[model samples]
Target: MSTTTAPPQPALPIRGFAEFLGTALLVIAGVGTAVAAPDTGTLGIAMAFGLALLVLAYTLGPVSGCHVNPAVTLGLLVARRIEPAAAGVYVVAQLLGGLAGAGVVLAFRSGDPSFDLSADGLGANGWGAASTGGYGLSSAIVVELVLTALLVLVVLSATARQSNAAVAGLPIGFTLVVAHLVAIPVDGTSVNPARSFGPAVLTGGTALEQLWVFIVVPLVGGVLGALVYRVLRGSDSDAASQDTPDPTTRAGS
Candidate 1:
C-alpha cells in the first residue's frame, strides 16, 4: 500500500494584495478628506469616512470582506470566521496599507506652503487637551470601545445573513457614519487601528505616544462584540447550524 498526503493549498497573494490596496484606499480617501478639508466641519468629515467605507465595501467586500480595520479583523477572528494565521496576515496588510495611504497624504501636503506636518499631525486621534472635543482619555477609550462594539455588531449581522446581503454595504457604511458622529469628538473615531497608525507615523510625538489606546480599546471591543454575536447566534455548541445560511438571507436579498 502507498501512502499519499494532500497537497498544500496555494497562497492567495491576490487576497493579501487586495487587502493591502483596499485598506490603503480607505485610509487615503478618509484621512485625506479630513486634512484637505479641515474646515469641512464634523458632518463633512463623517461623510468622508462613510463614503469611503461604502465604496470600499462594495468593491472589496466580496474579495476580502473589506475589513479595512484591525478591530474588524479581530472581531471576525474571535467569531471563528477566520483562522489565526489568516487574521495575522490581514492585519499586517492593513497596516501597510494605512502607512502607504498616509504617505500619499504627506506627499501631497509637501507642495502646500502652509502645510506643517508637526502642527497638523495629519488628523491623528487623541483625547483631553489633544482631543478635538476636549474629552479625557478615559472618555475617549470608552467612546472608542463602545463605538467599535456597535460597529462590529452591525458588520456581524449584515454579513452573516444572506437576506441582508443586498443592503449590507449600506448598513456597514451607515454604521461607520454613526460611529464617527459620536466618537469623532472623543478620539477622532479611531475604531480602525490601521487608520490610526498612519497619521501617527507621520505626525509622531504625542500622537505616537497615545497610539496604544486606539489599538487596545478597539480590539477589546471587537472581541466582546464577536462573543456576543456568537452567543446570540448559538454557535458555541451547534457549529453545524451556525454554518448554515441565516433564514433571513433570502428575505434581505
Candidate 2:
C-alpha cells in the first residue's frame, strides 16, 4: 500500500516573481495617478492606491500571497504565516519592483517639458517640507505608526479564515483606502516601506534623508499589529499549530 503525500505550494522564486510584478503594478498605478493628476486631489489618489491593491489582491492572492509591501511581509513574518527566507525574498522583489515602477513613471513624466525630478519630485513619502500638508516629523511618525498598525491588523484579520478568502480583498483594499485618506496629508501615506523606497531613492533629498523613518516605523507597526491579532484572536496557539502556512487563506498585505 502506498500513502499519498500532499503537494507543496509553488516554489519561492515563482512567488517572489509574482510579488515583484504586483508591487510594480501597484506603484505604477498608485504613484502614477498621484503624480499625473495632482489636480484630482486626495480622494483620487486614495482611490488609486486602494483600487490597484484590490485588483492585485484577487489576481495575485493565490501566487505568493501577493504581499507587494515590505511592511505586509513583516506583518506575516511576525504572525508566523511566512518564513524568514520567504519574507526576505518578498522584500527584495518588492524593492526592485518599486524601483522599476518609479522608472516607468519617470519615463512617462519626462515626455513633458514641465516635468522635473528635482522640482516636481516623484510621489515620495516624507514630512516637513516634503509633506503635502506641511506636517512635522512628530506628526509624520505618529500617523505612520497608527495607520500601519491598522493596515497590518486588517491584513491579518481579513485573511485569517479560509471562508474569508473570497471576500477578503474588499476589506483589505478598503482598509488601505481609509488609511491613505487619513494619512496622506501627514506623510504621503507610507504604510508600506516598498512603496516609499522607489520614489524616495529616485527623488533623493528629504525623501531619502527621512527614508529610515518610513522603513523602520511601518515594520514596527506590522509586528505590533500581529501581536494585537494574536491577543484578540486567542493567541498564537492556533497559528502555531499548523507548522506550514495554510493554503486556503492566502495571506496578502
Candidate 3:
C-alpha cells in the first residue's frame, strides 16, 4: 500500500493582517485604559497595558511572534534571533500599528465632555518634571534602562531558547506586567518606542518634546539586553560547532 503525504500549508495574507490588527488593539486597549480610568491610578494603568500585551500576544504569537514593541525587536536583533533587515522592518510595522491605534483613541475623545487632548497628553513618556511622579532626567534614565533591560532579558530567555518555546508567551506577557508595575509611576512604562511615538505625534506638546527619552533609553536597554543574552547563551559556540543537532532529527545526523 502506498501512502500519500499532505502538501505544506501556505502562509495566509491574513497573518500579516493579524499583525497590524493585534498591535492596534494593543495600543488602543492600553492607552484607552489609561484615558478612561485615570482615576484608577498607576496600578490600574499598569494592568491595562499588561493585559493588553497578554491578550494580543496570544492572539498573534503563531503568526508574527507578537512583537508589538520595537525594543523587543531590537533585543531580538542583538541576540541574532532575527536579521538586521528584518529588525528594521518589524520596527517600522510596529510604529505604523501604534499610530493607527492612537488615531482610534483620538477619535473617541472628540465627543467626550472632559476631553482635553493637551492636558491629558498622548500617553507619551518623559523625565524630570515631565515624568508622572516627578522623576528627574537622570533617575528616569536609570529606571527606564534597567526595567527595559529586564524586559528584553525575559524576551530573550523565553523566546530564544528552544527549551522554553512551548510556554514562552505566558512568561513573556507576564514580563510586561512586571515591567509596567515598576515603571508606570515613573514614565508611564514606555519600554516600546513605537508605543511612545504614536501618542507623542498626536499630542504635539511636551509629549512630543520629551519623546527623545522614550525612544533612546529603551533602545539602548534593548541592545544591552541582546548583547548580554548572546554572551550568556554561548551563541558563537553553537554557531561554530560541527556537532550541532539537526532540528528535524532526534539524534546526531
Candidate 4:
C-alpha cells in the first residue's frame, strides 16, 4: 500500500506578502481617490474604500484572511484567531504596505505641477484645526475608538463559523463605508492605524503630531471589540467543547 501526505501550507513570508499587497492596493484605491478626485465628496470616498476592501477580501482572503489593517489583525489576535508571531508579521506588513501606497500616491501627484504635499493633505487623519470639521482631539479619539470597535465587531461576526462565508466581504465592506461616512469629516476616518500612519508620515507636521491618536485609539478599540465579541458569543473553548464528540456516543459506536 502507498500513502501520500498533504502538501505543505504557504510559509509566513508568502502570507505576509499577500497582506502587504492587499493593504497597499487598499491604500492606493482609497487614498488615491481622495487625492485625485476631492470633489467626489464623502459618499464617493466611502465607496472607494469599501469597494477596494471588498475586492481585496475576495482576492486575498484565502491566502491571508485579507486583514490589510493592523486593527483587524489585533482583533483577530485577541480573539485567538491568529498566533502572536503571525499577528506581528501581519501588522509589520500592513505598515510597510501603507507606506508604499502613500508613496504611490505621492508619485502620481507629482505629475500635477499644482499639487503640494503640505497644503493639500494626502488624506491624513487629524483633529482640532487639522480636522476637516474642526473636531478636537477628544472627539477624534472617541470617534476612532467607537468606529474601530464597530468595524472589528463586524469583522469578527462576518468571519465567524456560522457566518455566510461566501458573502462575508459585503458586510465587512459596508461596515467600513458606514464608518467612513460618520468619521470622515471628523478626522478623515482612520479606523486602521496603518492607514493613518502612511499619509501622516508622508505629510509630516500636524498629521504626524496627531498620529498617536489614530494609532493608540484604534488598537484599544480592536481589543475591546474582540473581548466584547468573545463575551457575547462565548469563548473559543466553548466552541471547541461543542464540537467535541460526546464520550457516551463514541463508546456506543
Q: Rank the candidates by lDDT, best first.
A: 2, 4, 1, 3
**Candidates in descending TM-score order:** 2, 4, 1, 3
What's the CA error at residue 84 for candidate 3, in Å?
2.4
Q: Top model by TM-score, which number?
A: 2
Candidate 1 C-alpha lDDT tens digits along 193-218: 88999889879999999989988998
Stretches of candidate 3 off by over 4 Å are 1-18, 236-253
Q: lDDT for model 1, on a 0 to 1 scale?
A: 0.75
Of candidates 3 and 1, the better by lDDT: 1
Clashes of 3: 0
Off by over 4 Å in 1: 1-11, 236-253
What is candidate 3's lDDT per residue for 203-238, written digit by digit as tens? Answer: 887888888988899999988876776677675523
The alpha-carbon lDDT assigned to residue 231 of candidate 2 equals 84
- Between candidates 1 and 2, the one scoring higher on TM-score is 2
TM-score: model 1 vs. ground truth: 0.88
Which ranges in model 2 have alpha carbons more than 4 Å from their true place? Answer: 1-7, 236-249
lDDT score, candidate 1, position 204: 93
Cand. 3 Cα-lDDT: 0.69
- Per-candidate TM-scores read 0.88, 0.93, 0.84, 0.90
Per-residue lDDT of 120 in model 2: 96
